[model samples]
Target: MTLEQLKIGQRCKVKKVLAQGMLKRKLLEMGITPGAEILFRKVAPLGDPIQISLRGYELSIRKVDAKNISVEIID
Candidate 1:
């Protein structure tokens, strides 16, 4: 499933990132990569930007961007 599909507090591992161009590069630079583990942390009431824990850091990403990330539930 996509990262955007993750519910709050769910943990998952990155499978593949489907984004392209600069956005893809930025996501990679933010430490989101294949095999990386992620924990869904929080989301706005409106559900746009979502917070996640990755590589021991908290990262906030847009729901649009999250959609490009494929993940598999871990726990």
Candidate 2:
């Protein structure tokens, strides 16, 4: 499933990031890589950006970008 599909407070393992061009590079630079563990923290008030904890930090990734990230839901 995609990161955008994960529910809030859910934990998932990043399977792969399907983003391309600068977006992909940006995500990589932010520590979002394949096999990384991600925990969905909360969605923005408007649901555009979703807060997630990854690589020991919290990141606010937009839904559009989240769609490019695939993850396997975990406990």
Model 2, 27-68: lDDT tens digits are 888988998999999999986899999989999988988999
Q: TM-scores of all models?
A: 0.95, 0.94
Q: Pick the candidate with the highest lDDT.
A: 1
Backbone clash numbers for all candidates listed: 0, 0
The lDDT, on a scale of 0 to 1, for candidate 2 is 0.90
Q: Between which residue pairs do clashes occur in model 1?
A: none
Whole-model lDDT per candidate: 0.93, 0.90
Q: Where is model 1 poorest over a 10-residue stretch in terms of lDDT?
A: 44-53
Query: Which pairs clash in model 2?
Result: none
Off by over 4 Å in 2: none
